[model samples]
Target chain A: MTVAVADVPAVPPDLLTVAHLSMRFGGLLAVDDLSFVARAGQITALIGPNGAGKTTVFNCITGFYRPTAGHIALERGDRSFDLDQLSGHRIARDAGVARTFQNIRLFPRMTVLENLLVAQHAKLMRASAFSLAGLLGLKGFREAEARAMSLAEDWLTRLGLVHVADRECGTLAYGIQRKIEIARAMCTEPCLLCLDEPAAGLNPRETAELSRLITSIRGEFGIGVLLIEHDMGLVMGISDRIVVLDHGACIAEGKPAEIRNNPAVIRAYLGEEDPRAGPGSTDAPGAGDGA
Target chain B: MALARAAPTVSSGVLRAAFGEALVAAGIAFMLALPLAGLRLPINPMDSVIFRPWWVVVAVATVFLGRLGLALWRARVAPSRRNGVPLLDRALAYILPWRRGIFVAFVLLVAILPLMPFADRRVIDLGAVVLIYVMLGWGLNIVVGLAGLLDLGYVAFYAVGAYSYTLLIIHLDLNFWAALPLAGAFAALFGVLLGFPVLRLRGDYLAIVTLGFGEMIRIILINWSSLTGGSEGITSIPTPTLFGLTFTAVPAPGETAFHQFFGIPFAGVHRIIFLYYLILALALLTHVFSMRIRRLPVGRAWEALREDEIAARALGLNPVMVKLSAFGLGAMFAGFAGAFFATRQGFINPSSFTFIESAIILAIVVLGGMGSQMGVILAALLLVLLPEVARDFAEFRMLLFGGAMVAVMVWRPRGLLAHREPTATLGDLSRGREPAP
Candidate 1:
């Protein structure tokens, strides 16, 4: 199912464009001259070994870290936001970029439904007139609250979490928690979804389900997905495009088949082995794929 | 005969362990009681120290017996753990199911207490004081309980409120009704002021800064003698009126006495009952506002921030604004209670706004369970009434209080009521298909 390079231009336009991104942590150049583009309505997987600056790229894109030198442009409608220039929360609030952490960062004590509702806080807050209307239980605020609840319910039902919707996030299993995190990010109604290591701790069956969920999210929401994953099987299975990174630089970029056969990508994963050794190596990639 | 022999072996092992544990506890108790109870220094240096060996003996004996009983109890309950739940927890489980009913009953009881035949002057006064603490606890619950900000100097805002009211009335000739909201606004302003510097701080560091701020306010009140009257305090501050009708036995010139306006016989109890109702109204307003806001977006944001600040930020919540609002609103309630405090006492002093008062209010919020309104009320009742009830133990009143607090912590470290009801539910709960948990 590999497509020719000439077919790329006919695909959707870029939703996120990262140009010459470099992040320096004192003596260590965590991300050096990294560049990639995630197109709208496409799944772009950033795959690399551990400490290959994949998450650094994510942090820069999500405004968690201000890159030492870079231009991160997020296109939405006619306006383009310079993400590196924005603060951590404004990136999500103004630029419509939502992300999940590598480690699940759900509101553990809060119920699953409340976690989703909290993500819609900004919208509901305005509709409630900062709580004056909510305090009064006015019709406008009630309608707004009902709307938010339905949105939360929609996501809960879609994720097959209706049964545990009332359960606290902390008490749920790891795979469920991961799915809830994605649902929570979707509640923000972002134009681009950034998932960091969504398949990190999932079993093969769970990873397969996650891959399907991510695919459906992109298809249904019509939003770009920027994924940072080490699960090569999941990535190779679902990614529309794959950008392979090593030593904070882009080693290769193409479709899954191209990346699978790319010699540099193999060396980056298998580490200095002969290129002809191929995918038959019994040894796991040093990237901690958890596969 | 064989069964009896096995029983003795098991009983002897248990007895030996219990005895050893009791001995250790008694030794520690002896050391602790040595300076506190065994010996006392003479007032005059020339006099020899007095010894109280019997006091130490009593302490050691009590410790030994207490430890022995505890060990035996553990030994007996360890095998059948089903019965090992604390008595208080068992009672709580039964009572918690009827929490809403209990709250209604509690409110109704307090409402009719002043009218009850058994209610005397002292009882009504105690009720007023408890209400003040209740209001303060609810206010601090927003900051410490909901927002997860430890504000050790909350009394600073209370002081600001008290001083704002007194100074407004004295200097500007303003009445209580007029000064009430203004006092709250001033305290909120101070809350925002304190919040600005501590926005970057969290946990223990935030607590230390707030503690300093509280002391700083008190010190400023003291040293600014020209305004606050130094440590001497301001006296004869005007009390609140029933819409211009003063609660006085004799009408002063143009003033109408409360009894005279109402055509009732003059009685001093009228004033006490009136003050009780005034504080009650203010506290009820605080409670209603808190209860309503708990389900609001801002309130959920506060809880979210408490649960995880980073997650809240990712959701586009401005931590600075949410925190400031918590501090401001919490301090505003403290301000209202402070104004009531000033009017109730008919005097204003820095000593009235002490660290101990702040500690007591914080304790009420924590012991009640953070962010639990009913918990605060129950905790306030326990804390305020316990000390008064144990007055017979005068010197040991605080000791009793400390012991009670320790016992509660041991049984329910998360507070008396830590369970949180979700702000909203979906599907089955909303549609009534399932009972609300």
Candidate 2:
């Protein structure tokens, strides 16, 4: 359900600017001088067939792997951070960049509440010497813990995981696990959330729920979301902008409708048609085939 | 209708699990009885098999109970057209009661141990020694067990505490009691300094650095003759005194200390008992302190860091501080144990604080179970006491010890005992509360 708030803040454009980013793995070029922009308060989809170097770019931006060449800057109001040189943790803490794994990376043995609390570890350290001094009803610590608990509970309720809050993260159902991962990432209060295939293993109903959740997060939190999804229906319905990639190079960039009809995207998806084949020759032999 | 169906299903599952356990018990009983099962008893002590007790009542009880347990389990597991049981429930039926029984057995043994006929002087002395290892095992547990950080140079701190008290008492002319706290302080200082360099290393690298550190201290003691007294060591170190009375054969001032004070015979055993009780109290104090720390915020952070360093950092926990605290606190315990050891022995040498000592302490913690206080104590006692009792089997003692350790680990890869979950909460020990972000 879309919230009817007329005075909603407009999403900022160019929240993340990638300038000539390239990553080489020895002799192989994973991403070749790729450049893109993720707008604020919007769902920007990065889609490609397998090996199009989408994840490589995500890794570069998240500080897991340093780029061989390029600069990634995050704009917050008038300030921007050159994220290329920062460490992975500093990227999360200082640059307000958080992400979820294609395969869930929740701490399996810890409780759901703990997973969310751990994301706020930095903020807690700043407030107290871990004195837990106010952990119970202590003014500062209690307020912080209460806030974290409320946020965690709010997200868990939205995702239909309220009953499983005390269970181990590892024991949750597969679909619920993905929602927890996303909630955990959000708990960090990131300026930009990058999800690597958030709907990869979800059922149709779960996928629909995910689509609604993403749009609402953007609208409610006013944070930029960069997602890589293979489900065409979910992508077309939710994404404000889409970037198509083929062989580690951008093929098309536009609104979903524009991208759907782009000639280059069609070619990448459907190889050249063999005139001799038959009526279905227009589908292009060996092109756009979903592996 | 649902209740009727669920009842049969649940009870049957319980019966099945009970049967499996009974079979295992029966097998164990048979093995124990094999020597006397109409087969010739191995009269020769050097028989291929190790010493086997011939307690008749225990043997009968093992057999009868084992059979009954197996029968009940089988009846419980017998299939019927009733309610469907969840997979987890079936597994739980088998595991929960088994562990509960182990807990009961351990408690009973500890409760009745003092009343046993073996409360003779030798047994009491052995108990005292076992208590010492319990302290050492607990100290090492904090470093390697709870923190999941391998510390191969742990004995270095022990050596520092011992040498500190010994040298100060002998050369500086300080009383034993006066030098104890100073010795602990000296060890803690070295622990902090070690934390600085090894901060960059973790896992295997951390273990290697700690190993090198222990050896470095040993080398310093061996090579630096003037300061440490080198190979000769500092001997004739004074034993602990009870107020003004010494444990020496010559007795204390004015009259025989015990005769004058308690109007009792002047027996050396009284002193031994006093020292034993003292160390036992100190060891118990260490145990309680460790448990308190484990429930604190610092303890939770240590577990978090052990589980996933990257995730812990993302949560705002500074790894440097977390790690330093673990090293410092763990070393502090070792320092206390070291001081107590120095006063007990009345002498100190580099030979006494070798790498082997470190290895034994670590082996006790790991072989018991990581992060378990009670498990570590049990392990320390079993490992130390068993070997001492098997002294007459000197030729095969080392082989049996190594073999037993390997077998136990293989059977329970996690450890002899493992906790189902962490015990501590953040607010208590980790830190006081702050507002969540």
Whole-model lDDT per candidate: 0.89, 0.75
lDDT of 1 at A246: 89
| RMSD (CA, Å), each prediction | 2.9, 8.9
Please, what are the lDDT tens digits per residue for candidate 1 over residues B254-361? 999999988999989999999999999999999999888888899889989988887788888888889999999999999999999999999989999899998999
Supply the global lDDT for candidate 2: 0.75
lDDT of 2 by residue, B273-333 (tens): 7667767767777777777655445665677777777666544456788888788777777
Q: What does candidate 2's lDDT look like per residue over A194-257, in tens digits?
A: 9999999999899989988998898899899999877777777777788887888888887776
Residue B349 accuracy (lDDT) in model 1: 90
DockQ, model 1, C-alpha based: 0.57
For candidate 1, what is the TM-score?
0.95
Worst 10-residue lDDT window, candidate 1 chain B: B428-437
Residue-wise C-alpha lDDT for candidate 1, range A1-291, written one tens digit per residue: 334333656789899999999999999999999889999888999988889999989989988899999799999989999999998788887798999999889988889989998999899999999888999999998898898888888887787788888899999999999999999999999999999999988998999889889989988988999999877777777788999888999999988877777778878878774557655553323222322
lDDT of 2 at B174: 89
